[model samples]
Target: MAVQSAPEKALETVGPPSAVEEGEDARVRKKKGTLQDRQDMWRIGREQELNRNFRFLSVLGFTAVLMCTWEAVMFGSQYGLLDGGAAGMIYTYIGAIVGFSAVILSMAEMASMAPTSGGQYHWVSEFAPPSCQKFLSYITGWVCVLGWHTGIAGCSYTVANMLIGILAINYPDSYVPQGWHGTLFVMAVASVAFIFNTFLAQKLPLIEGIILIVHCFGFFAILIPLWVLAPTSPPSKVFGSIEDRGGWGNNGLACLVGLVAPIYALIGPDSAVHMAEEIKDASRVLPLGMVWTLILNGTTGFVMLITYAFCLGDIDKLLEIETGFPFIQVFLNATNSVGAATGMTVIIMILQFCAAISNVATTSRQLYAFARDNGLPFSSFLAHVNPRYTVPLNALCTSLVIVCLLSLINIGSAVAFNAIMSLGVAALLSSYIISTCCLRLKRWRGEPLPPARWSLGRWSAAVETFAILFLLVVYVFSFFPLTRRVDAETMNWSVVIFSGVVLFALSYYFLYARKVYSGPVTRVKQLM
Candidate 1:
């Protein structure tokens, strides 16, 4: 008997192909019994749709901009300076990059094996025990959805506060930074992001590419001037200074609380993982994009931290500057010209705003993916994609509404808004812990996983274990209040809100979702 040619075999399996059937047959024949291959086969089978508009560089750019590492450090440095002082900030940042790298590496491996917009939840469903898969995946989805949604609010809030900071720089005594001002700015920033996501969706690749350029060179643009003109603190001051402004009593507790800033900066490298469906060769490209983005951003963030510490002149004056941003004050002092300082501040603001834009895009994709699995309140409408642009217009609008609603908390209490921001970090890390622990359990059971284009090989177990342990530490500290003393104004409400989200998800699952939701829907048939 002669072996059949590829086309002949496809025809035998799928029958004589019309134009559309012919393309489907080709994809079906290419399935190789791997998890990624199964996902592709499923997409073709179910007629699931997302245009593969991102190439490697574009995806990398998207991931890099989403991290916005140096920008985050600048925006969030106050926490570190207040709690850990210069020494604590510098050392904690280094520790965070190391710990976060482990988590990213583990996530990248799983991404290579099962690339999907469903991301952590999908991986959890695949690796979790059959008896609990539905419940586990359902809760994971909710956690991730809330995390990304709050992420949009958090990033936009940063942009909003920065804009106000700029205003305060120009207006000084007259420009009082109020809670309402931040809230209004958040609405404005989110609105712009919504317009870009809907009307200009097709241009995202180009936009991200340009933003990546700015994210990289913008570091040097700010750094060189500060280094050249700013009066430097002695090495002792930069490396050895430690303060307890948090009133935490114990210096150790203060340092632990300060870890939140750097950890939050590293949270969203997995943002690209949610765009798996939009990237060409997603299994390979997704992991590469994630790991490389971490490396690039982590390195630059560390260098930027050192520069800020060394160039930090009068700590007392910086803290008192009306800008609400220490870096802006540092820039002004370094240049000795408000004009140059404002120009540099504007550049950072642009990068931060670009980050908010990318945050909305990624968050909407996560929303669309969850809704497609019938996980949300109005799944049908929320999951609808605009055919012309192949973007989730409805989901984008829905996210905008939720973010705006959440921003309202800022008006009543900035401390409350801070809790919502903490929810983003805590919720995301919770999802990470669940998915990673599931993966580790599968490996420990000696179950076979599909071959990955990117593999950890002999180091898989060690890396996964370290990732889990490190994330557990970060998760615990994320809920700690910056100030030791508790007041309505100073209390950390993340624990309260995070617990509420979990309780609601569990209640909804038992009440309705368990009967209807069956983990991720298998839109494709098994190729074997």
Candidate 2:
């Protein structure tokens, strides 16, 4: 018998369960088994051992906390201001909100259709042409896996830097942050995330729910105080002023480089896609969760950017503050009390820690899925799900180890580590481009898609086209150096690092993987 394709298998599974034939064995088994037993055996067998504990609200909370838009702007706005000034910050944020909204909508539609933990790669295999499907899917899986691994390192590194920033506030005269210090802090933060992902795995949804409340309410906690205490700038200065501190000569080039900041902030909403298997009614819930995350973060992030622009005072002095982040300087200048600034910094730190934990969860799930599909070396070991916890224990451990190794880069060269962190945007956007482009091609060719619970219907073509084009443009800019004169220290290493990852993945595929890996296995019955 010929094997069914993934799309066909998806349709078969979604259809009504195959009826049990009536006979002695069937009747006795039907009588003994519950109603669920009468359902398609293939469908039941396909479900990997993961707990589908996430409801719509819980998933929304998870995605919102992962995005953490307001917090990101607070810490990452320096790059925007350095390149774009106040006007660039405002307009770039608006553009990013629109652009990323399109990107996520396209991804959400794919999630609705496939609803698998493999996310982009799985979609690529389903939609890509048969001849290139395996190769494309394999490379996409590696890119996503490495993108998320770097993302974990980036989040933990930021948290570590912030913690050191707080210490600087307390001891301005004596505090000096060393590379080793940041590395140690990264390890510390990663350890906390490991504990949560392994020991407290079941509490993730509830924890994310609580963090969502903080994500919303915490906006007021920081914003209200800043607005009340900080001296405000004029409308022109807040909305029209442009700065080119990076010596890029052309203001337009500066603005393009600055776009990376907001793009980075908007990149991880797709983190929820990796959790599809662990989400209840994932076809509908995943799309709803992703779109709502964008709306909530986009609105809050825009307001926070505006607030930052207006409250910014004495640019030179703020930039000169001993703390690594300019936002800490903003707090100090506004409050004029080290104690108050440190307190507010602590709140942001808590939220950052929560976001790091969520990153770990997402990274592990993606790794688990890819390994389950035999897309990674040591697939059996990495894909093992813990019976007791119903979590990917081995995969989580593997991610933790890789994160620890990546954090070591901070010790030798913070600049190089930063370049690695910057890979998140370029790497992820490439994956988005491939998957969305595949989707658009399939739609354009009128290939019949499996029915999707959450779909764009009439608007799907336009949205996918826009999303693919937008990502292609952004993917190019994500590699531009921040300053005109690039040196070892100032270079934007995203392109180099991203290129190296792709090269390694392709090299591995040609050397060993192509023979063993055949894209996603069609035997759903063997998944468990």
Candidate 3:
């Protein structure tokens, strides 16, 4: 994005002068802090926030829409199912049920209430006990930053690697870059995702729309091959019985590690809700988007999952296929159609391009919301919105830069890159848990923050409770070290990720966060 227009007189230095007064008052109020507590609750449709400018239904639908097929491709392939380590378990019915329960219960309400880009931190500041507000919210923001950015990095890497796999499978002799190929490809892909969003931010929905159509159309296109050519295979032979694969016991922890497959695949469905303010009837539409995405992607993904399982004649052969994607082999087996498989592969690539484009918007909105209130360190730069485009140029660029640096990590340490992505899960899960815990606490105490036009009603409390417990379990499991000895070929990336999250959180506490970093530039809402 072009540099934002020069703010007239440094944008009036953002926060109102009264912030100083409020800061002083906050200190005095805390001195007399009681369990009764006090909250700086602001009205929902305040001057600082532009209530709802965009069409809510469109934006909400768009957010959750594409997630339907995105993960189907991921989980339907070997990477998420076979190699994503944690996701393998997640693709299973039991694991998906657990994840579904968590998302519906916990994240749904939090997204409705806090709806800000800073996500966890913005939420923490408004809700946490007055005394611990600074530390808790700040940590939540930092951790969430890790989760959001690392999630982007992970997708970039995953897509890059998949593209490379396409090349290695099709053109074995082609001169692909060595050792650092992934890093280079990651850079290139990030550039594409960034350019589409930055220069063309306004047209994003159109592009997103096109992507959605293609995703749906492509699913149909590929189904023809599975039905026509692969009809001979049946569930009895192809999909292994629980007894055949040693069910859950023999797989042991390896199965648990596979949870990442579904987790990664189902990720970003909530992206639509993040753009709540941009949509027309956001309250009505956001939840609808979630349901739409869930149904669409859920149905397609399950079909692919079960079909692929049924079609596979040999699990070992599927695993040993030289090309990283074993599903191509499934197509080859079912239809004896490399040509069709190749076609499907191309379709997926196109859809992935679409997914990447959507991701840029996702990251931008997040950065914009965060910087709007000066949540990040470089508030002055990141908070600037391009007057012409009405987009947050600095935040967009910052996101791009983060992804580029993350890509470089693939060259220096592949394990580090993987670990970062793993930690991302923990980061996101933490945000979900904290937000729901806050909601429950708030409800229990009868505190009135702004209510959403759309709400879950009495079930809100129960949903949040279930979500909190589920996320806690998921968080603990995310940190559980992968068993590298089970497969020495791949490094145990979990330890590095778990440790990195700790360092980032602790470092924030040690450095700038101690004194500065007032939770979400509430004083400067107009600037955002």
Candidate 4:
């Protein structure tokens, strides 16, 4: 159960260096002077053994549900993920839940075999043939990072928006914003979460557990009130046929357009696998967490949406809010008391914070893991560990900084921030698609799958193939602006996904990947 130290100890003990070799040896070893003496390397083994009491399984499920708990129940039901401004996204969410649900089933199996810090990138490296490993893993890392960052930034601003909504409901004329006000609030909230994560990644599982309890229990907080205020709707209206939106011409296609909105809610469910090195018994805990997390989220989110729709009966009225946050309007009407609506707003804000916290853990650890493997730009420095905390302190701090900078974008344009957040979902879903396709390809090639605690067995290939198609379909839709409106403003999400790739490639070929960075490094390199 003990992990071995870094592999550089061999070079350290060499006799006072007088003999020096030049060429190839110098490229891998950085120290100035003396011949690059022969260094011993350790074969890969299960070394980053984390503490293991089934912690991840207990926490991860709740993390996923807490994120969408508010969104699905309050918003999706009214708009049906419609794609109209924020209101229409109700339909988009339904599609995402269905799509991601398929993808996670596939990923849960993959997680058992290659549970590590690298996640999609590492899994691709191990399962892929040597020739394609480098390129595929690199692409996956970029996509994954984009997705994680989007999820984090989305959570931060979503939290801010929720807080602002709370302010509006509580105080008259609290519209306060030169745009910078919301930005400042977003940054402050994000900073607080960032600081907490940097200081407390180790305790995240426990914090997530507490959040989970509130996340699930908080549904009743609203459900109880809405049920009392408005009991029932015509069954036909609630679940019968798709209500008309626009341009769709048919309800069937409108459903397709709706998929783009909720894609993010279904993301980060498997994020626990990114922290495979941190979870104890990750092979077991992580997989269970990934699967059950979806189950918990899917069930609650579905029930919550149905209940809200049954109670809400009026889509037109819900969409009539002056601020365009229909969920707030729902509270204002449902309670008829601004004070009670303010209380519900507080609950929603708590949920947003919980989402941010979950992402901080998953995202920072994944970045740390990728860097540990020499896949990121300052990998050597980023892969460092704080011996006292036994945490990837450097990498965590770097991730915090990156997200903090991303928060500023909110100041200039919430639309831009929302668009980037959308693009991130595309990139993320793309990574999942690629990862699942890898699984399908391996089966076709008759490659032997690694043994793991959780797997889909006979259904594995089919499940993965289904997931790939699901994500591909949803990702394709991401390019279209909802409301049939295309500008720099809305659903520009796909643009950033493309931009993130172009940006990463530019740097990879010219800067880091070529000059200082290389391939598949380990903590072993740092030991030197």
Candidate 5:
């Protein structure tokens, strides 16, 4: 062999880059370019405070677990059974999926336009008329915040109830479930979310990735046994039966009330959108995360709904189960083993707790974003990002406080707590409706929108219109009492709660925020 100089030897040792390596290098460069492009488009300065630690799969996992659709469908099946019965769940679920598709697609396109932790409020700022941008954006921010807070409470309640449900199943004779017991569990559940979101923040993406497996595996784990071991209803009963157990007096009204179950199961696909600032190539990846989560969760949730409907045994008996959870009875009936049902229920409880963790993460980021814009009462404090963990510790704490307070309502009355939970869905839908209307108005006026990497093309007009209209319809129905003979326990207080928040936001705006606060759009250098 010929003698070689030091430089020549080093080159030979390193070797040339392969095609695969070069391709990957190009992709990485493209990703950086996209991120920079998005930042420049948004024209905001504080993008670096939170870490971009999430990628596509992790984000998808975060949203999938956050939605926990199939599990929610089961948890919420009783209301559907009471009004719409087996066939009603099947049909309304189908309709809700179709209607919600428009809302998700519309929101997805806007997310691509401005992927930020502010979510609907951010979009409202960008898309609304300049004259009303400040007011609309501020109101949207508050409503969005209200929505997420209620969402945290709702998730914690689910975990708490499931835990108590397990205890009631195993120790029925001794465990006379007290309302305070569930409240204590709710506190514990909220604490878990706060700890993970604040202390283990770095591990969230990895945790979510792993939990995604459990999400799917648990689906099959509970599903296979139900299909194999449970008694099945005939096709006619499963597909065509409808009941008006709520005494709504008409099949149409009963079905409408039942639609709440499916809609609630599907509402939070935007969980990924609220984490946009913490995702690589967020403008593109965020929309994909939201869309795919919805598709996957919807498909699986629908399948599970059909399965549970068929295996429901006796609806009245399941409803009367001391655990206060119909799904526990379904699992028990299917497996015919207390241990087996406990195991399956534990999987659901675990995933729900996981969802609560993700909920806290998203809710904190959202509150932090609004506070950064001086939209909240304690704007500076709530916006603080912990220097050590690079997480919004203060925001997380605030969310925890609100969650605990909301859960405290459970001790007063389960019906009241449910009403608070229902407010979450209504508030979120209101935010959607406002943002979609703003986008549609801007489009009609021929104004330039922020360039969208994931545009809906010509379908944008039709999709946005349908989203607004469908959302409005759902919002109206969401406030109606399940039965016409409305009483304190049976009445839907969502509208009251929603109106109160809006009134508070409006009052606070004129009283304080209006003087110091501007919409997020005003912070955009390019727009200015």
Candidate 6:
């Protein structure tokens, strides 16, 4: 039950790191390095099993593509356009960038301190009150895992439907869209992600490096066409209009609801934090990768949003388009050529597919980390790293199966599948709220924190406080349906699904995990 505070004792005395070493001396040694010391301080049992193939640029690429903000803006613009219009989307997006900046900075500080693949849960384990650490950490792990799985589902859904959209665009009259079609594509996307994360895990850095080039260039490719070819809206409409088509009855509330798209686009900046062990100079590179990805993606996403606003053509017609996506309509309007629009649409699809691939990797790593600490069923199997590939093959397989099953929900009801996917937003924000709140409580009590290579220095208090307050507001609105009048079809059932996940996790804990699970903190109790 005791927690360890010193690193040297843990390294020297806690056996041989863990079962997941490259060789005898490649990872663990008598002489402690800074990375090892930090890992020891956090009681992370797993050695450096995954290759440290990711440098700053690759990490940045991974985070950027995972978020894929500009592409998300286009994919999700329908909600914003109907509820909040051009002015609303733009202003809310700018606010999101500002609000999430605080979040990114606070998380960067925590990543510097712990730098573990467990991310928010691991930080909660270390920073929460010692008497309550185990329960809180266990709950956070479940929430974090739920958030990640939902994220993969959401990204895969986007990628699959966009592929369908392309078909609809080309065969407008003959191709009848079916829910089963989307489900099949979703499964296909998940299968591809599994293959890449398993067999091609070592080549991720190089792959992401290439995608990063495409991520940047694709922005200009889409942007220049909109600027040159699309018909422009007046300044008043682009900057002053507020369309309240959602029947929210209040423009402000409608705009707030519309913020979901932009916020969802920015949700995964902590992505790099979950891949910390695979990143070289994790304490330093993790923070840099996270913060810079936010800044870089935010700038480009903002410009894209504004450009889309100007070139949006007709919101009402686009919303009812056959393809079921508004951005395709926008591109078609801009170029007046199906071939040109398909080319641009394909760019977004490719980036989103890439996001799905990285999302699978990140989610699997988190699952592996949680399992390593006995937080889930079959912990030992799920936590096993293939000694040859250095990848958690079992965890990756589990995640793939989960994704395929979740996709089945779409076949039954697209609305229900959407509700399930929405769980990611609420679940992730809950983890962020808990972790940042725990960090602030420690700081307020003047408790000593783990050494941070990327400290916020004098501004840490303000940043953490703002992050909590802002995330709480977003969390509440995230569960609000786009309309005031809700039916089973229109309901935002994410809150309901999230509660179900919470209930299941708590029941599992009390029934089984309470006895078996010790939380990650106890692993370092000997060093204290």
Candidate 6, RMSD to the unseen true structure: 3.3
Q: TM-scores of the models, in the given order?
A: 0.91, 0.91, 0.80, 0.83, 0.92, 0.93
lDDT of each: 0.81, 0.80, 0.57, 0.62, 0.83, 0.84
The residue-by-residue lDDT of candidate 6 on 1-528, one tens digit each, is 354333334454645333344464745432233445445433554455667778889999999999999988888887788779888899899889999999989999999887888999888887888888889989999988999998888888887788888888888889888888888988998899888887889899899999999999999999999999999999887999988888999889999988788888899999888888787768888998999999899999998999999998678888787676789988888898989999999999989999998999999999999998889999999999998778899999999999888887745343654475568888898899989999999999998787787899999999999999999999988888877888978898888878988999999999999887777666543333
**Candidate 6 weakest ten by summed lDDT:** 29-38
- Prediction 2 global C-alpha lDDT: 0.80
Better model by TM-score: candidate 3 vs candidate 5: 5
> What does candidate 3's lDDT look like per residue over 351-422, in tens digits?
665666666666676766655444566766876777666667777788888888877764423345446556
Query: For model 2, what is the error of residue 319's alpha carbon versus the real structure, in angstroms, after optimal superposition?
Result: 3.1
The top-ranked prediction according to lDDT is 6
Candidate with more favorable, higher lDDT: 1 or 5: 5
User: Model 4: C-alpha RMSD to truth?
Assistant: 8.6
lDDT of the structure predicted as candidate 4: 0.62
Show how many residue pairs clash in every candidate, following the order shown: 0, 0, 21, 21, 0, 0
- Compose the digit string of candidate 1's lDDT tens values, residues 65-117: 88889878877887788888888889889889988998999999988877778
C-alpha lDDT of candidate 3 relative to the true structure: 0.57
- List residue ranges in candidate 5 displaced over 4 A: 1-38, 45-47, 412-414
Model 5 per-residue lDDT at 446: 98
Cα distance off (Å), candidate 4, residue 228 = 1.6
| lDDT tens readout by residue for model 4, 1-528 | 112234534543443334444463642332221121111111123233233322664557445643564553453333343433232344455666676777887787777666666778766765666566666767788778777876777777767766666666666575553566566676676677776666665566677777777777887887788878854677665555464454556665666666654655556677777766655555666778887878777777666666666665466666555443567777777788888877876787777777777777677777876776666777778777676555667766776677667666644453654465566667777778777777788888997666666888787777777778788887876655555555556445557556866587657846666453333422222212
